[model samples]
Target: MTGRRVAALAAAFVSVAASAGLAIVAPAAAAPGCEVDYAVPSQWQNGFTAAVSVTNLGERVDGWRLTWTWPSGQQVTQAWNATVTSSGAEATASNAGYNAVIEPNAKVSFGFNGSWSGTNTAPRSFALNGVTCTGEPGPSPTTTTTTTTTTTTTGNPVPGDAMAQVEAMQPGWNLGNTLDSTGSDETSWSNPRVTEALLDNVKAQGFKSIRIPITWGQHQGSDHVIEAAYLNRVKEVVGWALADGFQVMINIHHDSWQWISAMPSNRTGVLTRYNAIWTQLATAFRDSPGRLVFESVNEPQFTGSSGDAQNAQLLHELNASFRDIVRRSGGNNASRLLVLPTLHTSSEQARLDELATSIRGFNDPNLVATFHYYGYWPFSVNVAGGTRYDATAQKDLTDSFDRVYNTFVARGVPVVLGEYGLLGFDRHTGTIEQGEKLKFFEHLGYYARTKKITTMLWDNGQHLGRTSFQWSDPELAAQIRSSWSTRSGTASTDQVFSARSGAVSAKTITLNTNGTTFSGLRQGTTELVRGSDYTVSGDQLTLTAPAMTRLSGSRAYGTNAVLTAHFSAGVPWRINLVTHDTPVLASATGTTSSFSIPTTFRGDLLATMEAKYADGSNAGPHNWTSFKEFDRAFAPNYTTGATTLTPEFFAEVNDNARVTLTFHYWSGATVTYHVTRSGSSVSGSP
Candidate 1:
């Protein structure tokens, strides 16, 4: 149902679509030998990244070609690690030079970026080597449901400026995994039926707003008519929030599956349903308090990778339709504040710009921009089983919030962190950690308050008990309240100082505070140790020797030989930086061989190694080959025969990373090498 609590990765499902206007042309079935899993890793306005993995369940073929049809007009832009060709709705992807061979029971992957017009739909079927691949088909067409509900327009109206209303909702909570449950029953997913007492408990804990993410599409028919039972149930729950003096936000939760985000072909259908849904909702709540806010959609994203321009246009149209439709519904809806989501509801600078640009020129004083932030992945959500939050993690989190503030809040646009919370899963007990989740809540609460951004904590019976109407851990709940309470007085008055470096030998940096006195001088969240890390003289800050050690990774260095990297598949790696004046190695082609490192300036010049590889496509996990940096005087030259050389400074090194390199020979012998790196040593055995 697109509930924030439900992990989308584990429940990844394929969505297949047949040509809307074409005859039912069944593909020819070849001998059962392989299976394929096709996926859309990402999508934007008019483009998307498509990936497919093929497993040789039978005898291996020297080469393979995977084919699929595009229901709407789509064109391939570029492909990596594979050769892709498209003709109308049909397209084929074959392996590149080094990935042509496959052994029995082995799997290979390929992917491409494609553009689309009108509507975008996933291929209904896929074929490998002219045979239909066996695997799960796409989501089937949902049945349309129709129901009629008695009209009721009743409730007191809220008063205040839209921004003031938003500010009033300082700390919020999401009634997640309850009414938004995808199961047949509300309690099927293990959360008890939401009760008034639960709302009371939430309010008692200092939460001022409750966001209800309801899946209207699931309860609607093909014609987009929402069943009366479902609509009334949502209204009842929202009523509870409003009655408890809580700000309420209701949105079209899981509308992507309904093709609401698809444009052109399904544009008409999508708009029709979207407008109808809001019209009905606005009419029902015509007399309700202004606290009952309407959200356009949750994570309103195009199905495939769509270009930003296309996504921006689609989002614009959808948001305009929402604002226009709801306003025309009369009653308190005429001036009710609305929430608009950015692309992917992401905190990315580019996506935020897209949203700001799309909604520019239109004067909507009663609107609040919203985006979701769970910036520290693997630790925020712990998807990859990581359990540490280091200095870098904290810096990233701060930087993300800083961007949002500068982009939206600073410019007079009120924003809300619609949904944010780290997963509570504990690695030790294999159960949700009520206590551990508090630390994250504490941090988020502090960040949100300082940024002056309204925040809604996502809960799905994980942190609080629904049946008992009590917190699973009262101390955890108390910690959240305490964090929020800190914002009761003055906000943090620390000013950020950038260590601008132009020359490699520059040691003194100036603070741009314009004579304003400030402390807590940090370089990207790493607070400088005054006497040891750096020394300040007036408005100038000078770096100490420890700063260089921290940057060069010298203190952590050891006598290790070569740093070898093995990729899951052949991927390009570019070393050295190039500018308009001085063009160095702009590109390099050795994926397995060692290279000569070059000197780089800290800020003015950067010798970077950027590897581009599609996650889970044409390659397995490339642990070490992600990104690396070397020091200014660092240079490493390793000989394949027996040579050794000099000790170089490494700014950062993912020393021990597992990489699987696949090699396909013209002689039909496929060889696989497993590479391991420790410190600077590179060793691999096939």
Candidate 2:
């Protein structure tokens, strides 16, 4: 599983500004005029990253080239969004294919990583297309002021009790993959534009708060000025949520990784842009009630820092600046509840401690600590043979929550789980088994409630259908809702497997009563007799042989029957009666470019695959673990009756080595096979 919450796009924008104290050279009247903003956002002992934005002030130019002479022996090591070449002390950058055109008064930006000597100073002069730039653009254009009318009746008055206000914002929902999308617009990620009706639908579903994650980089222009249209759109959505009585949270979403991550090197530029963003936002919503919360940054992380210690210090600086700007902006922001996150919004002990220190330093009671939880790594993405929500996953959750609870909640600092969901859910809901996914949510909700951490479900139009405004899995949604109030009983396994060719034996499931009493078990509307069909002793629910055989009608493969375990309260647990046998694998010959083991699943479902060499070392991609990453190194196609080993897996494995493959099925059956690769040719044996 990945450590970051969201996968960052490659072409993220960095903060840019013209270097001050740099000498300027005047160009001839016939020469085209240009202005450049050269900023180094990240710098270390010997390396640094720089972002450059060049604006054409002269006639329209179809293509542009920027040249600058390093004053302190800085060398361009690598670059992106533009092509940079260095010779001696001078360096030149040419626009990439897409950004080749520069309309009159328009700007284009690019970034690069470079090396520096003892003293890394900004370049003294810059020339665009052989013409020396004045370093200053023409007079500023007229700025339009959007006057927002303040309505006292919009939201509840700002509450003095921060803890109480945070508690009231329980059961939050995230409007993800919408405004936060880094594409051209909100709909760039295929989610519809935010509508008041959508907010109404979310409110109807018991969500008291909404997190609007907006990526402001793409919508910003030179000098880090956010476009008026984009700012207005965000305000419109925030207003809708507030009008619907939602505690709204708006933050610098993707921009955290985009530009904010360069704070260590470009502290001046990053802080300047960051302060401008918050100043505008604070000014816009200054009159709004306290329900409007401002999060400093989403998953704030710093690159090129000395270490975690330096990263923590950088985050503190940003948080401090954010708080200072918002508070001084006046109106409701003076005492408005502000949320600050640790590095990457992680719940680890170190990250939590750093956040606690920052909060204590602020000495503000209206402050809240924030973090994100995406479940345990392996089970989250169904990697490393972790296909179940076992003790390990449970312990991970409890330990994380316990640390945060002890560090903050117990000490009177409110905590908000800014985002919570399985990482695999982002790919597709079925990436993890339905039963295991449900159990995870059920346990997560209960534990978070006990810890007093408000969880905002990160729904990127996967769990909930945006158009229909209904959950794809109503049962999963119901379980999450129930977990908010009380704990729900769950079974060890939601499935019972019976061999198709043999006589069925009794199947027992360990129930986690979780303080709830089990009512009975039923298949559809027919309730099974307790003595004859099943028996419940203590926390064990056992299905007799006769009942198992009856449930496995015709001894068919796959799910034969679905049984619901009803509890005295909360949502019922589903128990699927499946008939499956040991899966069969066949030998095959192919090339490393493409290879697959013909499989006869025989009604069994594939769980995960493990690959190991003769030396007992891991093989294939993610070689640190014997079990290859799901869907990346290998994928099971039930319809094709084959398990395909992707080229990515073969690309990493030794060319002429034999690797043992173990296929694990959900039915608890494991099959071993061997495959040998010679050059590009491969052969498998069962």
Which of the numbered candidates is closest to the native, going by highest TM-score? Answer: 2
Kindly list the per-residue Cα lDDT of model 1 for residues 1-686, writing each as its tens digit. Answer: 24332343222211001111111111111223677877988999998888878886655454456678878878777776555656677776755434656776788887778888777788888776666777532222132112101000011112238768889988888988777666655676788777889889888878899999876766777777788887888888889899999999988876644567566457787788888888888888989998888888988777553444567778888888888888888899988888999866766454565565444434566778898865465454332323334454566567668767755676566788998765434221212223224445655777877788899877867677776767765655665676675421111111111222212121454432311243543444355477776676765655565454344342211111111111122111111111111111211111223423231222112122222222322221212223211111121222211111113212132345544433221112233334444555655453
- 234-270 in candidate 2: lDDT tens per residue? 8888988999999999998989988989999999999
- The total of clashing pairs for model 1 equals 20
lDDT scores of the candidates, listed in order: 0.56, 0.81
**CA RMSD for every model?**
21.2, 18.0
